[model samples]
Target: MFIDEVKIYVKGGDGGDGCVSFRRERFIPRGGPNGGDGGNGGDVIIRANKKIDTLLDITSKVKFIAEDGGKGQNRNKNGKNGRDLVINVPKGTLIKDLKSGRIIKDLKENDEAIIIARGGRRGRGNAYFKSPTNQTPRFAEEGRNGRDRWLSLELKLIADVGIIGLPNAGKSTFLSRISSARPKIADYPFTTLQPQLGIVDLENYKRLVFADIPGLIEGAHSGSGLGNTFLKHIERTRVVVHLIDISAADLLETYNLVRNELALFSSKLSKKSEIVAINKSDILDTETSQIIAEELSKKISKPVHLVSAVSGNNVKDLIKAAADLINKESEEDLLRLSLPDDYDAISNKGLTF
Candidate 1:
């Protein structure tokens, strides 16, 4: 029941109507109108909650309507205000208007909230109509209708590092070993249907959150295999851990195919900081692993590491390297932010992507 995206209808509560009554007190014979004003309607609000990891609870009940305000009473007694409706969703949820497909808000942080719809306005009472020209006005204003709208909700996973590769390339295996997340792993391809997030505690102070995206095959950018559904989950990732099955045939070809698919999907993603890991090193001889690593380094122009998720060989060193890269990128980002806003060097300082 990991429902991430869903469409739902929401409406604000309608305001209460004003009362129309005249004062009929025993002592006060010339008493004027004494009607009370109505209370305001409730609002429909959406808040980002870190505890909510999915939209399953919200999807169960599609329509959400707030409570209506209480009507006005006699003797200038105001009505009770309606209770506002609050909806909780995952932190990385995005809300869009159904008709125009315009993005209302992107809730990426915890406790972030936005008012999706407003409650109806309260009506006026006869007491408010007491004017010099028309002192004995009898009519009272009507309450305004609440706003109703259909909205589309989407969820994108936020992670520090993304583990991506072709089917059975050991992406999930690597994640399962490095962290506490236990994803379905099999000898066949596409064992994981959804993205899995895991937290890695390499050191007491250094914590890393990694996401294992669904396997990407050729034509993945054009809706092939798992397609772009899971690909967007890693858009916020700072580093990409590219896994290559050294035991598979044509390792470099598989790597290039995945890279090409990334370029087609998003140029910024293709340029993300990445490191190549030769997976399944335990299945290969020492000489063979070294040969493959040497060639991969030269081709990708990045330091290639040999790792075996099954034996946990060189996994620590690989993670340390990734942590170093992540720290380096963070420092550069802070430096760019410190630069003057109007400085011409800001653009070239790797600020925007």
Candidate 2:
């Protein structure tokens, strides 16, 4: 039950009413206005919590409201302010206006919070109305109303590398082999219903985060076969591992189908450098596997590595190639991050992680 998108209603608390009373003490002969002022209302806020991994908890509920302020008391006392309502969501959640479809905020960092709705202002009491011209003034200012909005929350998973291919292409198997992630592996399509993230350890304590997206079929961009529902998870990935089951009869068509889906979905995703891996090589003869890899490389104009997820043949080499590419990209990201904010011109030239 992994939910990445949800719509909700949020409202701020209303301000309390002001009190209009005069001091009536036994000792005092003529008491002036002693009414208390009303307290301000509470605000509605959404915070990013890294501990949260999904939006299932938030999607369960539809509306969120803050507490209203208490009314003012006598004896020039101020009313109590309302408590603020804080909603916790996973990191990478984007807050958007439902009606306008505009992104309001991107909560990417831990503990980051944004006030979605503001509280109302408190009213003024009649205590300060006493003057020489007017002895007793009974007027008071009214409180203001709180802000309300309809917000849409969308979550995008954070990963360094993305693994994408047609169904039964050994993506889940490859992920399980490289990392501790154990996704369901069956001889069928759509084995992975949800996206899974795994951390791979390289030499010198270096690590790379890989995201395994659900298999994409033909017309996936057009809402067919998962309908690009999970494609957004790979937008942030720096690299894409294109794994193909070498035993497929139409190897080149499978490659083209996935590529076209990527392009139709987004240019950014299609432009990412791919590490084409011809999987299931253990089941195929060496000569046949080489021919497939060579043909694919020639068609795509890139080196295609051959590997077997079951027998672990040439799997290390494939992983090593992915690691090398990741290292190079990671260094470039570090350099761009280290640059001063004023060096925008130079930073723009560097590639993003």
Candidate 3:
């Protein structure tokens, strides 16, 4: 039940009515107006929780409403304010206005919170209207209504590196070998229907989050196969590992097909730093695998690594290469952030991918 998107209605609590009472004491005849003010309504709040990874829990309930305020009491006593309603979502969730399709908030960090709907104001009591000239004012203001609107929630997985390729390209196998994630693996195509996440630990206590996105077919950019559904998940990644099967008939063509789909989906995604990995080296001889890797690297104008996900051969080298690139790209990003507003024009010191 990996739900990434959902639409629901949310509303803030309504304010309570003000009391209009007149003081009536046996001893004092001129007690004047002693009405109390109404309490303010409760607000609807959204919070980001690190424990939540999907929006599946919110789908069961469609509408969310906060508690209404208590009415004012006599003897000039103010009413109690309503409690705020808090909704917890995943850290990477995005809250948007359903009608206008505008992003209201992007909860990227844990413990971050924002008020999606504000509560109504409290009403004034009759005693507030009493002036020096008007000793017995009987009028009281009514409470205002709370805010209500439809909202859309979307979740984009946060990962440091993304493992992507065509169907049956051994993307999930590579993820399971490197990390604790155990996705479904089979000899057929489309074995993985959803995205799987894993955390890989490296030397010096450094770690990286990796995501295994579902396979991409031809026309994946235009909603073909599972590519369109899972492509957006790669947008947050700093680097991507393009895994290609070594047993494919044409290695360069298979690589180019996936690249073309990525370019069509988003230029920004295609521009991210990439690492080419020729998987399933155990199926072929060492000499043949080396020759194919060398040829492919020459054709693509980039270095290629041959690794067997099942046998775990040369996998460590591949992981180290990915870690090195991640560190380099991160340093460049930090440098760009430290530069001036016109940093791009001044220097081309960012990722060249």
Candidate 4:
């Protein structure tokens, strides 16, 4: 039921027509022009809401139209303006032009809104043309049409850390062990067909959001298996936890395969801060696990942590490592914000001020 992408058509309301009339009274022999102007049409707006988690509600109907303005009446009575139409979508939704495939806006914050279509203009009445040369002008202008377009909405989940690896790498089990989220788990591959999100509460009231993406296989970037469909969900993650099954025949090859797939999908995704963890360590002896970890660390040139999700052995250490790295990166980001906007560009040129 988690719908992330949807296409819809939106249209603004049309303006009302003007009226041409002449006033006539019992006492007055010739009255002046008394026609009224038409009202303007309504606009189509799209807003972001934090409470809404999916685009399923918007899929119920494809086309959305605003209310049209009322026509002008006699006695100089103007028509009523049309009401604006507001559509609510989940936060982190990107509105794109379907025809041009260009991104219009990224709704990352709640309450953010944008007017997608503009309403037509109102028409003029005969009274507006009443001048000295044409005292009894009977001409009236017609209303203009509204704007319409086809838009595509794509949703990307926001998370602090992403848990990624090949299928059946204990990702679901690891996530369940650390957070309250309950995702379906099984021994078979592709058990998690969709991405799962969870919140891990750390010490000092600090928390981190994690997303467990579906397993990646060979040719994932090319749309093989469930990789391409769900890989985009990890693009927003600040950090990634690479989970590897310790029982794999070639640990180094397994690690490289997933990394290559990530790089192929997005260079930015592969360059993110990564934490390598060997899961299902409870099956092996402590000394044996440590030896394997050390060997893998030397081969990959990165520290390898061995943890068992089932027994909860050394899992806290892994979480602590992720939190420490996240805090470190956050501090760096804050420091960068405190500096000049061109600090990086200026420093890279080797210019001394």
The best candidate in terms of lDDT: 4
Candidates in order, TM-scores: namely 0.90, 0.89, 0.92, 0.90
Could you say which candidate leads in TM-score?
Answer: 3
lDDT of each: 0.80, 0.80, 0.81, 0.83
Model 2 over residues 92-211: C-alpha lDDT tens digits?
788899999998987877899999998888887788566898777787666677789999988887666788999999998887777777778899999988888777766642577777
- Candidate 4 stretches with Cα past 4 Å from truth are 330-353
The segments of candidate 1 whose C-alpha lies over 4 angstroms from its true place after superposition are 27-30, 204-206, 331-353
* Location of the lowest summed lDDT over 10 successive residues in candidate 1: 340-349
Model 2: clashing residue pairs?
none
Worst 10 residues of 4 by lDDT: 339-348
Q: Candidate 3, residues 265-342: lDDT per residue as tens digits?
A: 888777878999999999989999999999999999999999998998988888888888878876667333221000
**Candidate 1 vs candidate 2, TM-score winner:** 1
